[model samples]
Target chain A: MTPKRKQKLFVILGLVSLAAIAVGLTLYALRSNINLFFSPVQIAAGEAPIERQIRAGGMVKEGTVARDPDSLDVAFTVTDYVDDLEVRYSGILPDLFREGQGVVVVGQLQPDGWLKADQVLARHDENYMPPEVAQALEEAGYSPADYQAKAAEVGERLGAEAVGESGN
Target chain B: MWSFIHKLGSPRWFYAISARLMPWFWVAAALLIAVGSVWGLAFAPADYQQGNSFRIIYVHVPAAFLAQSVFVGMAVAGLVFMVWKIKVADMAAAMMAPLGAAMTFIALFSGAVWGVPTWGTWWMWDARLTSMLILLFLYLGVIALRGAFASRDSGSRAASVLAMVGVINIPIIKYSVDWWYTLHQPASFSVTSRPTMPLEMWAPLLIMVLGFYCFFIAVTLMRTRSEILRRESNKRWVRDLAVEGR
Candidate 1:
């Protein structure tokens, strides 16, 4: 190769090597932080440091919820069925939050073992179902068939009224 | 003055100066990192609220700082390449990609780790977090665009444009937390604001930031030097350097 061409080729090759080294070093340096994610069970088993803010995911246990009358703070229980944690949230609960739903609470553990949450996240279900209440119910071992049937009945009544109006 | 800038822009001149300083950068990075890490990790008192887990901030904060600062550096490099037609500037911009990306990832990951203990969630779409995520994507896009073209020059030019465009977004991202309701807190440390942290806390953090910059320079120089060698491989000096050593 000509000198100019060779120089260009060398430069490109060198950059690739440099990038590789930087990436390798960074990963090596921060390996511990990278492995910090843990499940609720792992956290409860003392695998995670108690003082660290951790995420607890699973169903909000039914009938364990209480909202402070004066404050916006709401307290609820979360369970993986095998392990359970009480979580207190002092913010606006997402519209989807309810009993027996799959929710993730992000916050730190208080001295009393209750999860003091900064945020509460509610994930919806597939099949066009608003998983908010249902997920919570399902987590609490309740069937959604009753709610679904009630909704269908309401829809049918509305449809009948619309048809009568067209005929008139 | 313009000629001076042009002279400094020369790869040969940069190679000479950077080579002279590379060892010093390495020494500084190593020493500062060692001292800061030791002080911050081992000696720094546990946060009144967070206890010991807050120690991660020593690395996390520095990485976060470097992640943002390097992009600014890359953007400056992009501007030089566009205005002055400096190939070295383009090269610097290109070289910054992986480093910036890695630092961004480090910041994100460390933030997540810190979040889990303090906030209780592994991730959130908070303003600062979201902006940092976009920065990661921007870094990826620049690197990808640089390698996308059939011709290397075309690739570098494309990457330069992308870098400049992304630079415009940085200020928007930085100010978004203040403007918008965000779960992420506003910046704790700044050039003007009185630091919220005590001397013990802020002191180590400052040392870490300096160490990170030194580390950045050391790595960049090593990469740039290697780049020079590879690009100039067929040149007489490169051949002699290779042959003399081998």
Candidate 2:
């Protein structure tokens, strides 16, 4: 082979091998740790790793939030409308965090079967269907077409309500 | 294969070719960004929770994506320079560093701003935020290191090595929120991953992401051409073009 061809072969071989090693190492290291959050169903199915910090994400069950009368401690149940996990947090929550909103709590599960959350983040309010919720909804057979059509139907109902309210 | 590399290595050949490509990218960038920005800010329905503040995602997500992508692009160019002794690759890497750095800054700034009203904090040294900060530093380090060396060849080689080494950080930045406990949300836009948003909300964001990519390409082509003229001023072909004044 000519010198140029030899150099090209050498470089390509070297880079491909280097890239393969990098990919191999990265996949191995990240495979177990790649989950950003766990759902109530995953926890119920004994899939969530225990005692290690991970996020538990689900909707805050309606009327389940209980705040301490004197302190910042708050307790709530997170549910996918399928299974439920109880989360107790002692710190102030995000302003947008409220009852029935999608939430993620960062903490570890106590052996007693409750999540001791160091931080609780409400994903947003009632109307905000975050990607996690969207995924969950999809698993339940909801699609974008269904969501858009439902939104239009709601918008029309709201418009009619406003018109009647003004007429009265 | 050798002939293709040889042709691409020539500044005159690249300059002529990229001139043809750049205009199309510029036009596309302008049209897409304009349309995406308008659609996202006005036409898209307000979020049920955050309301209009969520519109920032149009600029923020695209900026953050580009910031990481440009760093990886710089690393590939550096690898090309190191392995093949490609002068054009080194030139492109040098031009890309500052732009990548600027994009990283924008992403961090926008993220921080978005946080104040949402997270109620200006900053947090969480995994995602910290990794992105390190990416910005890596970009600056490459730019500064390249300029620090007295010999151009040594500087180019040094920058290439740094760029290639920094390649490890790209995936870390991408997966940091997922792998570690952090307040920052996980990846939103993925080919295999479905966004929680309905089509109305995410469509403008997709357009914005495409526009930002075109913007990166158009600017990189313009800057690389400038670098070529500066580096190859002594070449006969460059001198002829200057003489023709065309």
Candidate 3:
């Protein structure tokens, strides 16, 4: 082989080995952070820092829904049966949020145990639920529809206009 | 350990080991992914809330997990190249760029599928999605930079620098919500909390995660081996190894 060819080969091999080591190390080091989206039950338990912005997800509790008369602020409860959390958000609530449906809120935990939501998200369709929330419900022996169907009347009142607008 | 380290530093040794290991990883990854996906998608109970759409998690979470992991992998390769001056590391880094980018694409695509049902919109400038998009760009940058240079050595070095810089940004990306009033939600899972998923649900997830890792290892090794063979084709050992078999 020519000397130039040997040198080129050497350089290529060196780069390949370096890339492998990088990947191996990265997988090992950030395993914890990468797994952060898996389980919602842990987030609600305050296993993650309360001060850190985090997601709380579950079905909106049947009768715990509340709203502020004057502001975009709305408050509701999310439950995984054994554990329940109150989530308060001041925003244009997503069209899908209502009694019994699945929801995920991102916010900080206030001292009073309420989740002060910076954002609220509702599940998109009749058949789809947020993966995390659905997982939580299945584990809790609850179903999203069981809670969702009961609140249909109220959900319709809140969601009707928004749903129509989105259809356009 | 020192001797072992020396052996590992040898490109031929690394290539041979990775080559032998690739088949096992491919088989294991294929089996596990098949089983886990079938169980999660077909056998798992429909979500009480979501019914069937929640099935998207079967693909979304695993892809996102792989996407994040690839960047870290690329960065570590950069570190080795920087310190040890290993050319193989650069090749590995370059190979990872395409695979990582593919994973990121899957994650974004699956996330959108999942999002359409949950978020009431297909896209959001939210933290998680945006960070993921940034990660995609980083992968593209690495790949592009590697090809930009006239010298392979210079190209690898430039790509390594980019990978290292991107690694530093991971934390900032993860914490973007806390640092700013971004629309993205905070994390849902944590190290401290008891996993909220039932054994039925989480069991498959664990399988899928392991399978994804195995798949990554297999593909990377395959790519790396091709790289090694291509680079070392002129060597006497590589030539003799091939000729002797003939």
- Judging by DockQ against the true structure, name the best candidate: 2
Better of 2 and 3 by lDDT: 2
* Candidate 2 collision pairs: A131-B196
Q: What value does the lDDT take at residue B83 in candidate 1?
A: 59
Those runs of model 2 whose alpha carbons end farther than 4 Å from true positions after fitting are: A1-62, A68-92, A100-120, A123-168, B1-6
Candidate numbers sorted by TM-score from highest down: 2, 3, 1
Instruction: Give the alpha carbon lDDT tens digit for every residue of B118-224 in model 2.
Output: 76565766668877998999898899899898999988888877777777778778877655545576676767778757788889999999999999999999999
- Fnat of each prediction, in sequence: 0.00, 0.14, 0.16
Displacement of residue B221 (Cα, Å) in model 3 is 0.9
The better-scoring model by DockQ among 2 and 3 is: 2
| Model 3 lDDT per residue over B1-246, tens place | 877666656778877778778999999999999999999888876654555777777777788778878898998888777667777787788888998999999988987776766575667665567778989999999999989999988999888878876775566565654443233344433345554445676677778888999999999988988888788899887898788883
In terms of docking quality, how is candidate 1 classified? incorrect
DockQ of 3: 0.10
Error of 3 at A89 (Å): 16
DockQ of 2: 0.11
Residue A80 lDDT (model 2): 64
lDDT tens digits, residues A1-168, model 2?
558867865775576568758865975786545444676666765667788887787677779999999999999998765678999999888877877566678899887778999877655321334445556766898652242343244335534555565578
Give Cα distance to truth, residue B45, candidate 2, Å.
Answer: 1.5
